[model samples]
Target: MNTVDALVQLSFQVQRILAEAGAEHDLSIVQLRLLGILRDRQPGMLELGQHLGLDKSSITGLVSRAEKRGLVERSPSPHDGRGVLVALTPAGRRLVEVGEAQINRRITELTKRLNATQRKQFTQLASVLVNT
Candidate 1:
């Protein structure tokens, strides 16, 4: 495969690994992503939609579902009285922790064949790609 094809295939492979990890925790990939993003900071619905590249309705539905599952909660934004912020609940944090551990293990297993230098190079390249 060419470089682009190889990168695409690698992307799919990584996504599969993440999907499997998310499945174990009963989360869709988007839901897992939401949890991951919420891990750092709570953001208003509009901001969350922007960060997730989702529309307002989609963000509303996603947050609603997560809230129903007790994984997340929506609160009145202190800075914006009319706006709501979405944040992970304590249960959500625990789930994310476990899900992350599973993803790390799966990724390690996938890359186990790579030598130390190759792994380092791969990490650097991935970082560059992500940053760009």
Candidate 2:
């Protein structure tokens, strides 16, 4: 297969894994992404929306739903009183940990045919592609 086809097929496989993991956790892919994004740092709604490629209203609704589910919290931004920052609650963090484990397990299984060297090479190449 050509590179484009190979990448597309691989993306589909990854998306399937993500869908399965999200379903297991009762999360949509976007919600899973939100949790993943929150695992490290707190960001204001605008930044989150930009990262997620969501518009303001859509992002607001997404955050509201997550907030209602006790998975995330919103607080006044330290830099701007009018701005709100979103963060993962303890429960959200736990969910992310579990979801990540599930994804890792499944992806590792899928890539089991590759030897250690191939896996390392793939990782390096993918990282370069992603970072660019």
Model 2 earns a TM-score of 0.97
lDDT of 2 by residue, 51-132 (tens): 9999999999999999999999999998998999999999889889999999999999999999999999999999999999
Candidate 1: misplaced stretches above 4 Å? none
lDDT of 1 by residue, 1-132 (tens): 899999999889999998888888888999989999999999999999998999999999999999999999999999988999999999999998988888888899989999999999999999999999
Candidate 1: Cα lDDT at 106? 87
Candidate 2 stretches greater than 4 Å from native: none
Enumerate residue pairs that collide in model 2: none
Extract clashing residue pairs from model 1: none
- In Å, residue 87's CA in model 1 sits off its true spot by 1.0
Measured against the true structure, the TM-scores of the candidates, in listed sequence, are 0.93, 0.97
- Judging by lDDT against the true structure, name the best candidate: 2
As a whole number from 0 to 100, the lDDT of residue 70 in candidate 1 is 95
Q: CA lDDT, every prediction? A: 0.93, 0.96
